[model samples]
Target: MRASVTITGSLEDAFNEWTEGTARRLTDVTEQAASTMRDELRAAMSTAGLGKLGRALGHAGYPGGGNYSIHPAAEVFVRGRAASAAKWEGVIDAFNDGATIRSKRGWLAIPTKNCPKGSRGRFLTPDQVAERFGPLRSIAAGKSVLLFADVIAGKSGGVRKATAGRIAQGRESKLTLMFVLVKDATIRKRLDLDAVIRQWETRFPAMIADVLKDG
Candidate 1:
């Protein structure tokens, strides 16, 4: 779940010989790469069926004397959703990892009465589900999920604060899915860290070379 690449060689010596501005330039490059990585990771999760969690994904950076570190993570509110979040993660992993899910009770069904007339008899995409329930203005996912009847009866007041808080904070219910998606082969290839680091490796030398030339 974690990866890092260290660049070593005469490069360090060259950086040491250069001005402080050169070190700052290297840090800028690292921060930019980290930003891109975080964005791509969020995008990949959205496409991999974890879009709901993308809102909570964020990144930060720390600069030291000659290096910087980027941290991309879900915030405290997202971490608070461990229980139901785990259940959803299991469902996604079971499907992605090729583990079959069988239920004697039959597919967990949702009523289609809320769907648009044309969408009534078919499976609805997430967008369609959102549209069908748009009047509710929010979804619940902790101990209880927002149900059709709850929306109908306007009984979501109790969780309305929690729902609104999540929305305002841009946190999502199923965040573990983002972590799992990062490890997935297809997603990993698309966000390949090694390739990103290689590009940085090539650029680092050129950056120092440019600084030295200016000096």
Candidate 2:
């Protein structure tokens, strides 16, 4: 985001002072661009109004593990607060939407009831379904899972002898929950999965190094 500060002094004086100070402070920093822009904006702010302000611009990278860039700009006399608020809101919305997919090593496994005793077919509760499938609970959280009952389907193919016992007892058979083993963490992230796997490679570099060393 960019912001400008007004200066009663000449534009050249303001620009020179601001640029030198900013360059000295942020030449090699990770946020060099943003820092420089902020300094320039502060210089402009020292001036009374937007009329004496020069241009200031900044680029803030994504706060989350996603790839996003925030560019903000404002002239003098304009309140920077509104623009800053809007930029922050945009970032929050992006995070809420789960724009980036993260990866993990293992999968979330859930077990469901294929059939209950005394029922001709198998049946599974929504909770059981969620336990087997990772996304069911996430999608169902803060709302009624019963509302999604229509979408749940069931099928039968292989049955264990013990499971068959329950089926013969009149358990209802139905598609309880869809089981999906996702190898990529990105899929869950897209589904708005709560957990964010960040810095996994860094955290597990020893294991990765071993694999690489062997390979």
Candidate 3:
């Protein structure tokens, strides 16, 4: 969002000084606008049910987690300063604008309903899954379908661990499906960061006027 300050009568002198980049109060106005932008961004994230991710804006210690800085030019954005910055940056971008996430590796293992979450309420990783439940064998369930992988159909056999329990009696528990390996996954756009920016853009002129008026 860009703040265009138009000076008419009483503020013409201040605007002229601002054009030459000599107006000291213009810095104050920029700071106020940037602060409002940061707050609105956090509010927007919270409204989109991304409170945890938004909290990272305040956590400068995190990889790519720095908020806003006061400068003559108003700016609010995430800066990648760490090794894992790209990973964390994608988190914000995915939520801001809808994204299609493809695996960097051969396949991306997505957790199924049968998959268990970790202690931190996050889905278990592939290594964690392997640790908890022995190992998971790979079976190309023909074409692109995870649902068919569990049920017997063609040359592709279902992934199952046969237990000692008698299946002849027909009271044995069904096998568990841990994950669905896919090439890519789609994430719908949920955050309106642009909307917040637009809102601040309109209010920026007034903010500048107040600062110049006070001076």
Candidate 4:
């Protein structure tokens, strides 16, 4: 997925006029602006809690004069991501466009607090859980779920994963809720990518001036 900001129309003409009769090149200034916008977008992604996706941004363009036609009249563009970094695009798009996720197969297995964590403390997947305790015992409810043990082990609330030694010894053990089966899940529109682009878009001309001034 990608979002971009482009300078066109009077903006392009104004930049050309600003750089008239000088050693400054449009390509150089545009590259600087694109780089600056990429950095700003990356930072905003972090601020919006989409830091991983934010770092995926890549800016490209600013070819020679004749290349303008191929580039849609913009010297450069701040692109959100590339194909190599496409894994996190869905997440970014979901936050930007808002989404309702439904299971493509059957039920969505959402990890519960009682679910066992991996060595890194991340929640284990269904296959990993199955490796630990074989096929999960299903419980009958509105949305059916698979549990570690048939009976809800004697505990306060949440499900538990019984230890290997306890199960072998035939002793009562803690059983935690592994997963909650749900039909769908919702992601709200939290990140406004267009707003971010516009914010930096306004600063582009100033960036060009700054580059020329420094040069």
Best by lDDT: 4
lDDT of 3 by residue, 1-215 (tens): 99998867768876665654534556655665676677778888888888767755531211112332223465665545675566667899898899998888867788886666778989887677666555555657754434212221112542333334433445344446677788888999999888877887679888777765765
Worst 10 residues of 4 by lDDT: 69-78
Ranking 1 against 2 by TM-score, winner: 1
What TM-score do all the candidates reach, one by one?
0.32, 0.18, 0.61, 0.61
Off by over 4 Å in 2: 1-98, 106-165, 185-215
Q: What is the lDDT of residue 83 in candidate 4?
A: 61
lDDT of 2 by residue, 1-215 (tens): 99998768698987676655443333223244334444544444344243222233334422323322222222222224788756544433343354533236454332234322224444544444444432342234232122121121234654322245456776554433333333332211121212222332243344334433543
TM-score of 3: 0.61
Clashing pairs in 3: none
Question: For model 4, what is the alpha-carbon lDDT of residue 155?
Answer: 52
Candidate RMSDs in order: 17.6, 22.0, 11.4, 12.2
Error of 1 at 96 (Å): 6.9
- Which is the winner by TM-score between candidate 1 and candidate 3? 3
Ranking of all predicted structures according to lDDT, beginning with the best and ending with the worst: 4, 3, 1, 2
Per candidate, the number of residue pairs that clash is: 0, 24, 0, 5
